[model samples]
Target: MITVPDESGIVPFLRAGPPPDRTRHEGWKRWQDQRDKFIPAPRLSLEEYAALSPRRRALHDLHRTATHVNLGLLETPMSAKVTKLMRGRLRNNALNFEPGTRDGLMVSGGGYLGKTETACDAAATFEALWRDLHRQLLPGPIPGTRDLFVPVAYCRTPVRATPKGLCAAILDFYAAPHPKTLHGMVRQVADSIRVHHTTALLLDDVTRLRLHREDDQDTLDLIRELMDLNVTLVLIGVDIPNSGLLRGGRPDPRTGQWILPPVKPGQTFNPGAATQTERRFDLVDLDPFDYDSPKGIKAWLDHLAGIEDRLRLLQARPGMLTEGAMPEYLFRRTGGIVGLLRRLIEDGCTEAIDSQAEELTVDLLAGIPIRLGNLADRDPTAGEIPEIPEDIAVPAPAPRPRRKGRNTVFDDRGERPAADA
Candidate 1:
């Protein structure tokens, strides 16, 4: 005879348990430390700066100061927007996740504008929050369960951006084997995501997806399927219009050609037939740094000061280099692009060190092998600095031809007559 358990007898097991002791849990402690690792860099004391080696000191000050500015205040608005969208999706999933309801974020920017880094930072924050929420709701591992529940899944978009490839990538993130067929892979990915209880998915470099391909529609549909499982999607890519991720028409399978949206003369091309999945994304553009802005100028000054402080400890003072026409010169040369500015500074530092200059000067900077172009007239009143010395011209490297397919070896003799055949 078997005993049957009553509701009253099982009440303790079914009731919500007390919160787990976070300090005692090694996993939670590790996660807490990881979250705290991204704290803003604090200013170093004089003695501390003096103790670092010359190379370490230079590289540290350069990266820490520059990255702090670019990734901190300048990126706050975009970061907040991403966070709001992600949190809203999470809330919707908890409350009422309707079918065909997919809220996504699209981060677009020019090349080298730090869009990838910004998206990654946002993803890290979301993962941390997800971990905290899981701990609160579920407390700890379930009895007889060997796998850990991962709420956030972040991955780069597949290079060959087909529907099958994307599904396989997601399955790979969950450490699940996928079937060879496209439909099979999709089913496996959906099952893995559900089993893992994933709440969000971040795909970076989505520009790799080809436009006007039949598979593109399949990829979009797969994304909708993922969203139906309550996963918030975030895509990061370059600001290219109509790359199939957004603002593009699908290929017509019958004709095997693109079915582009028609537009009248003088009217902008707008696709009125976008599916709910394509229209659900909220687009955010990350602009390059404005060197003319007061805030931007201050950021430059802070970076230079950081470099100077570190250099001073090595007995090579970069006095007054951060002032006068130097900032204007840097802005004109690099056009306020963060990546270009970093390269200019790194190369300039190397030149200064090689020349044994006690103080970095305007002349020393002009000599660095930097490719200068037409400068933007963002600030007319900033006034002209001395023309970059004519002799400082470093010829830009020749552009490489874009690779299309397999490598080809050309004959030395051009176009040999086919008459011999």
Candidate 2:
């Protein structure tokens, strides 16, 4: 007969941990929980880990399951620069106390380039600072209002989002009840946004809204109106510029940046609002690491070094990923897409542990295919090394150009440079 594990026991092995609720990730409770509770597993030297008893090692390995290979969020050149731009906009709008309507931010990029995470990181940082400044209390608290002091709100656009559905997503972020009607939900959302002191509202996957659809137009209109609720909108999407989000929009003559027109006069419901003409917004791009440039290659190698340092593998050594052909091999394997790289690395680490190799090698990681990211838009590399060293060295200018020349690499005998047979 099989013995059942104890449901209630003082021993840790006999107890249980609740399964993570991934569905609620867009909500505040889940976001805060993940943000506050995600602790990377401690790294132990191979010797120290090997000396541990089997039980202890098993427990430690279990702990590692959560974050052993996790590099968390990384700061690339593109992301670092773009994040500064977005955060500055968020700050400018958030600090304006006498604001009629604050300028918003739009971050667009290909899928899995950490666009949403970068925006969310900035927003979270802003919220943390804002709350600390307000002594963690409601900012300018209104009497008889019991809404939570939500400094930042985050949600995703529904695949078939209408104005009502969009409003519902916003309301759902706060777990606030709402009526079934579009107008009611919008009113509740506007009121809740102001009462709860939400300074930044992040709507990710905004490109999901089809501009051709009549409902999406209404939804976009509602988005502009929400800006009037004393909040800065943080819009994130995949390729927003190409998504026709800027319908009838034109690039600035001097700046050459797409200037999205403000809410149409017919779309306005509240005529008492300020002379709403230009809804100030800026669009930033987050692209994958480019391996063709020296700066990009340096950044990519540094990124690898960072990941190497964070790894908890027993046999991992310095320059394991950054030295020799490993850097270029990895770049080719994952095509320099951070998300795909992350998946390949994490999966490779898991395989290493299971296989008792305890180290990531090109041969080991090569077979683990890069199966992440949205295939509809981005094509991830299949984790194959076509050439170990694919000309990563920067070619210096020759002292003199030659009409015909051939590289003379040494033969297997370790002799001088040789010509063809």
Candidate 3:
């Protein structure tokens, strides 16, 4: 007979350690390096700007508008729904613990729909809010704690979603060791969550959990247990055949009882009745950006202009424009997906710079490979051109006059002085 480890071993694993302070951690540096390419809008005073070198100042003006575009997702209807569900969870969980509450948010979308990014952004916002609240309530650092409190925890679902694997993922997030058995792992995870005061958990790529039908109930049960502990779970993944949580369980005709697919004898399954976990989630679908609508085109152009505005503030040049038919062409090519649009713009810009072109042209964008969706045969101009928004429309720049002589000098103030003729 196999002897289980005593509860003491499990108890030690559950003891809450200090929350992670990412700012001082090595991972913080990795994050900074990854995002270093995108220049954020500077909040420094004029005096601070005056102190930087020309190169540094130039770099400061070079903004990655893609981030701004990503941020714009918050304005979408899907995001509003997600926000409402999350707020409800926070409010309800704070007042009283509701077991198996309808607190989970399911974000489903196609590839390149920015589902993962949106979920991550939402998680970050929640975590920041939690940190601020913690600081306000407990100004003094807790002795022996790395962080005051962790309001949110974000992790990707494991490739093989076993009960032990899921528990190990949570443990790894908190830098804790896990016991070999599923029962011990669950206890440790639940305890760690309580000790850290984690109110919300975001799991990306949840589709990975459905690989094995036998483990489906185990995964769902784990989620239910987390919910019972008052942890609001946000599940993000690409579109799946059925609801990510409630797939594969069917009703038995003879017994009139719901039965999940058979699992190995020792494997864990949901002890509760079937269809119980289905009610715990609020599903939110993220559709691709609508490039055909006036509002959609306006949003796309405004995102680019927002980045240009930052550069203009620092006397730097603009990149993309809104004044011509180029917007319509871009909309048709990218089919309104944010990821494709970003890639198209970035590749076009690189090509233009390499070819010494001052502005992005239709010819430049046409050269980039279309690897995303099947748009090879689709004509960008086949559909009706979306009417440009009145406020967003600007008259195209007047063509520069040709110089009469080779030696004529074009002044900084736009005056073209004649040569010594």
Candidate 4:
């Protein structure tokens, strides 16, 4: 057993180098640009991208981080259907609950949705779980797990997307400061974390791998390798159509298009209660916050206000030249898609500061009239648009079909209906 001392001088076995370098924004940018080609056109710029709060910024950074694995991902809803599926999987009897191979969870959503934040939070939660489990196994308490939530957005090490590269990346993850390459060191760290039952791995922006049509094998190999280490991997990314991340193939008569394998027990969809592999890693579908929903809107506003407050505090203090309010306004506009919101806000804020505004406000926000502005244009223009009232119930407009040509209903033959006198 390697004798490794943690920050608090508690030496048992595991030695982790300084958490991944948090100074690598350029690496992230390159990943983002590479990913943008495979996915739909992104709506956020790099400057707008930078203006997010550290938490929100990290979420967007994941796309850049995972550019090699799961690209061309789409946004799907975390509907009742998904939750029901999750509950079913969790309650299955055949689940092994083994230390090494329980079903893990994946956190995914729209490009701008908060997948990174969720992943980071899950990492923190898993570390806490590891500590709690360790306490059960050992007589004493474990330090360092108390604050497992390390912000990795600025980590400079270029993330490796290929199978071999990923292995190297994992090695680099622990090797920056030591004499041996990081991979050799990571095995020791992995052994330590594994022995302590702290092997859950959180990977954000996994969609980056979609660029390579053949790279899905790399992903599978990596996942299988982690599973061997008793590591529960949580991958975050934009949602794809089916449970499987990679799409495209021959059609299955049942679903028309070739149905990708569902995220089943041990990779089997809908594990039977008696099935032995039931308790493997799980797949979760995270939906975009229903920005139009009352609760969602409120949460978004609060996010905006909080960011604004952060910027205001920063500007008030020394050592902070430019306060950031772009993210706050982004919540106001994009409805709280942490990534896009940050992008819009950052761009707008920079423009505002460039023009020399003492403070940030709605006027400064106008600069980033992104797609949200287009959506807002469709909002009912009936009443004086007051601050969206709390607990207010705005009746949804009755559905109406758009008329062709003459600006009215169409005829039975698919032609525009003639106007009445």
Using Cα atoms with residue i matched to residue i, what is each candidate's TM-score against the true structure?
Answer: 0.58, 0.79, 0.63, 0.45
lDDT of 1 by residue, 224-337 (tens): 455545567777676634454555544446643233332223321112223333325556676554666788677667655654554322234454547667766666666655
- Relative to the true structure, candidate 3 reaches a TM of 0.63
Across residues 139-252, which tens digit of lDDT does each residue of candidate 3 receive? 857788676355666676665577777777677777777887777778787778788787877766666655447675577566655655567777777664354454555544
Please give me the total number of clashing residue pairs in predicted model 2: 0
Q: Considering only N, C-alpha and C atoms within 3 Å, which residue pairs clash in candidate 3? A: 18-146
- lDDT for position 333 in model 1: 69
Query: Which candidate's TM-score is highest?
Result: 2
Go through the candidates in order and give each one's C-alpha lDDT. 0.54, 0.72, 0.55, 0.41
Per-residue lDDT of 1-421 in model 2, one digit per residue for the tens? 1121122322232214554322232445455445645455567788888877777677666556556544578788888988798778777887798968777778888766788778877777777677778875535557896446777888878777788888887887777888877667777888878777788899888888778889988888777777788888888887787887877777677765555667888676444567775665677888888899899999999999988888878788999999877888788766687877888888888898889898998778766766544444222221111112233333233376566855667436665566752
User: Among all windows of ten consecutive residues in candidate 1, which has the lowest summed lDDT?
Assistant: 377-386
Candidate 2 similarity to native, TM-score: 0.79
What ranges in model 2 sit over 4 Å off? 1-30, 33-39, 136-147, 253-258, 269-274, 373-421
TM-score head-to-head 2 vs 4, winner: 2
The model with the greatest lDDT is: 2
